[model samples]
Target: MPGFLLHLGATVMCSHGGQATPTAPFARVTVSGQPVTTLAAPYVIAGCGMPPPPAGNGPCVTGQWLVGATRVFAGGLPVLLQSSTSICVPTGTPMQVVVTQLRVSGV
Candidate 1:
């Protein structure tokens, strides 16, 4: 599917409400002056509301992108899009892309 490209400034959050940030933004690609994200890097999460073990499997710490733009490549890696799918580690929850660069779209 075609969707807005995910940039460093994109608002991405885990299912538990933890904010997800790309550990390494692909500097070779830029969207609206911000570096674009790719499947090559993982995302670190913070401020997760999920409780610890014995209560709930939560507090997502990191994320890995399982899907990305099939046709758009940055540094030989697929660029992440708003429609990309990701999995948060330990929590087994998906990361949600709430906001991304509207100016750029990729499949």
Candidate 2:
């Protein structure tokens, strides 16, 4: 039996308030008709800090969906896992969630 772990890039939302909206619906990390990585249970929003707008003139955006998430598509099915707490995803920054970790036995 063999096992493997792949990372599904989950996009973080940038907005004020709560619930980080997924930038790309969900992070896709599966190739072929085989099960790749699985969404790691319990998502955590790792705040990707942002600096104030340039000279107080740049567009200032606040991140509410703090908790990072990891999602993917398996067997044509969608798997999404979000964090309980929130994390900041400052503007002009790219955020990703480790949606899940899939374990398969290559028998």
Candidate 3:
């Protein structure tokens, strides 16, 4: 079986409250992994909002994910952006996951 890789790189911004201004977009990501046949098709790239953790993690880090048309072969995925999610970082609050990378294999 041939192995495949996908590289996802992106910049994300987050807002905490409705008062403070949003912070600059950061970088978060995932590396290469197994590939899936389903993902090879030309599917609409959509942002799968941050999923809830096992337990309530206080609204979780406020970030956003965008979709694009790219090939996930056997390498890395780089996702870049200017304004992701919202613009407004609340004071005394911390943002999480500005950017990220995902890898899919086994096609």
TM-score of 2: 0.23
2-27 per-residue lDDT for model 3 (tens digits): 23222233222233221111222112
Best by lDDT: 1
Model 3 lDDT, full chain set: 0.27
TM-score of 1: 0.97
Greater-lDDT candidate between 1 and 2: 1
For model 1, the superposed segments whose C-alpha errors exceed 4 Å read: none
Global Cα lDDT for candidate 1: 0.92
lDDT of 2: 0.33
List where candidate 3 sits over 4 angstroms from the true fold. 1-13, 17-58, 62-64, 68-78, 83-107
lDDT of 3 at 21: 18
lDDT of 1 by residue, 12-72 (tens): 9999888999999999789999999999899999999999899988779999999999999
Overall lDDT per candidate, in order of appearance: 0.92, 0.33, 0.27
Instruction: Arrange candidates by TM-score, descending.
Output: 1, 2, 3
Total backbone collisions for each predicted model: 0, 19, 23
